[model samples]
Target chain A: MKILLSQSLMAYLSEPWPWYVSGGLIAIIMVLLLFSGKNFGVSATMRAGCSALGAGKINDFFHFDWKKAQGWNLLFIVGALIGGWIASTLLNDPEPLALGSRTAEHIKSLGLSLPKESKEIASGFLPAEFSKPEFVFSFKGILLMVLGGFFVGFGTRYAGGCTSGHAISGLSDLQPASLIAVIGFFIGGIAMTYFLLPLFYKQILFPLINELQNSFPK
Target chain B: MTKAEVISWYRIQEMFLFENFHMYGVIGTAVFLGLISVQLIKRFKAKDIDGNEIKFEPKVFSIPRYLFGGTIFGLGWAMTGACPGPMYTLVGHGYWSMLIVIAAALFGTFVYGIIRKKLPH
Candidate 1:
């Protein structure tokens, strides 16, 4: 069983053709968005939904009146769902990215409590605890997530756009603010990973890692 | 590059501010974008139909709002390991399941809209 799994995983990882295919598809989508006089931004799409539900028409950010413009964002969601599933299932690369040992240790220090099974100390990430449904719905988890969502929404509004608008659209358009926002994003991401996070986990993440390592195929 | 060209170049630099770096990129991007957006509202002089620009003037976002919002976004980002835009970029690359985040994001937006009138803006 182990051998079979490894072979399949290796095969998935070696599939280089998908990268090109996916890249091409994204370019096509970009062209379509450009032609429509609307930029593609997932964050903005949510704002659109908010407007639809009654956020008061303070701006036309959500007013993509064209019939085709209406549900195009939904297509983006569908596309992403399909993309992630394929990458994980077929590619067999489902594990979180290991940023580096030092980074990982820093994340651990943030009270994230790394899972013991995590191989290196600098793995730059706190293995996902909220990926599962149970964890996601938990009181503490859910509160953090919802509060997080509200923050993102409010932040995007104040920032005049979401990560995408700034990263892709704004960057492409040569917007200075977008440039700064992208920089701040990286800084903020690093600080959270290294500093503020430890205050919450309190060593819980490490034990989970230990449990995971023991269950490894080896 | 001309002055506008220089300015545009500068903007590009600012836009990509921390994308290549670690951690601070997310919040840096957010705040930078917000400030730029405020400037955009002013520079473009974009107005409402009455010939008066619909002021992009955000009265008072407050520090708490900024902190809370940054923390929330950072958490979601850390959990998913992909910010909102990249999530879509991932999809375009064929990560189909990212729709889950997209759906959740949309749902969150809907909920926010319903309660927007009551919230601090």
Candidate 2:
């Protein structure tokens, strides 16, 4: 009986669930959060973390009773992390992820290419070039990772919540501010992808790519 | 699945660029349904498990704050191809490089905590 149960669990993990299953689960969680009188946001966890670490002494923002008020949010982050790990590992899909042809063309247009050694590109998930230490340690990588992180951190707090909080929870509550914020997010995204990103690639990345290609000659 | 394929879908970068809208549609619909359910319960004045009335209060409106924050957040999203919520998922997918972005984000938050008093509330 135990063996049967384990086999079923393994089978369940191995196959991808329909999109609605996850969507329904999120909806349920959101409903629960609403009834419980708690705001569902991920960025706020950092504030709770700061409060737990005693940042209240320096600023009123972090002065909340984190253990009583914001503790559960921390657990949510942990759960998300654990859930992701389980999904990626135990239930790991044997097949490589598939990419839409349009997306492939779009990425190619951006002058991005995967390393030759990687077989994952055909499957369409993560690019080895982007994930490698050499890429991350490069000047362009540092700019994106470091400066981008700073922007996300400062912006989420300044705007009052991150994507999940504003887009999901705040939108659900029908907050006008969230609507405006979402619009702004889209505009920024469009501007980056169409204008700023291409400009960066042309001015900075192209030169790097050229230099690397010349040096490697493969 | 290949890491690149997973990252693309999870981050939804190409989708956003190409206007696929599948990711947005799913999230928006689910969230909207959740919102409608909450509204329904509130209209009925339903009590939670603890018997407390559910409240949905809109936050204060600050144009400048929203504009600044949203724009910066968008920039970060574009750069990293992941937002705060998805960042954890990226890490869970074994993209350890995401740790760099996460650490930097935490530091940014810490910095904000230090100087928040000087900023407009």
Candidate 3:
């Protein structure tokens, strides 16, 4: 009987929970944040960290009393990191991760190759072609990482939030700015996928890959 | 785990628009909306512990700034699958390379602080 119970528990942990379950949990957290008179966001934590590091002396933007206003946000991010560790390790799914067929086909259509086996797909969450040391150390990878990081950091601050802050929290509060920002996020995503991405792969990334291969002769 | 895999997910779902098409995203959004609505109602109609009316003012609204900021943010999101929040998650999941993005993002914020005075409201 004990063995059977253990098996069932393991099974439950191995499967992904239905969408509503996770969603409900997020809702509960948001309500708690609202009652506490705190805004929900991650980017604000960066500002708080900057202030804590004494960035306020140089600029008014980071000059606030971060301990009083954003202490909770700092704790919140720590909690998220801890929570993620627990989820990924303790409650990790035993089965291989799988992508939707349409997603895989679309990637292939973009001139990228995917591993055939389910186990390979699962372990290859970041494909080797891009995530491998050679690729990351290459000029193309460095540029993408640096440029992309700048855009995300600057953009989130300028916009006043990110996917979680604006789309989930701000939209929940029915803020007009969040709504506008969310729409902008969608348009930008579509443009990148259809326009910028293709051009990038064809002109820059592909050439880099070829050059690297030639230099190594592997 | 990798940037390419992350980008593929974006193509399938189109960022936060997943709420419009996926059950998980919708459920999450609905939950937030419900809770936020209740909070708004309480702020307007209910009293605090000391019988004082809660004064919750909405954030400042600026159309042009939001549009510009949001467009740039969207472009960034497209380039990187992990946002500020998920970047932490990625690190926790053992993708330490995400630290590069996080570092760069913080630097970007620092630059913004230096130049914010010059940007129009």
Provide the lDDT at B118 for model 2.
Answer: 74
Best by lDDT: 2
Residue A50 in model 2: shift from native, Å?
Answer: 3.2
Candidate 3, TM-score vs. the true structure? 0.82
lDDT of 2 by residue, A80-194 (tens): 6776676666666666444566656666666655223345532224556557788889887788789888878877888888777888888887888988777767776777767
- Model 1 chain B: ten consecutive residues of lowest lDDT: B1-10
Q: What lDDT does each candidate get?
A: 0.46, 0.71, 0.65
Off by over 4 Å in 2: A1-18, A111-125, A208-218, B1-11, B115-121
lDDT of 3 by residue, A1-218 (tens): 99999989977854655445556666666666655666567888878877888889989899999998999888887776665565557665555435556556555655644544323322433344444566566665566566777777887888888866887777776778888877777777667666776678888778887897899956
Candidate that scores best on TM-score = 2
Q: What DockQ results do all the predictions give, each relative to the true complex?
A: 0.11, 0.51, 0.42
Instruction: Rank candidates by TM-score, best first.
Output: 2, 3, 1
For residues B11-91, write the lDDT of model 2, one tens digit per residue.
366656764554565566667787888689878998776788877777899887787778878887777777776677667
iRMSD (1 decimal) for each model: 11.0, 3.3, 4.3
| Model 1 per-residue lDDT tens digits across residues A106-154 | 5445433343443232111223443345655765456545554444555
TM-score of chain A of 1: 0.62
Native contact fraction of candidate 2? 0.57
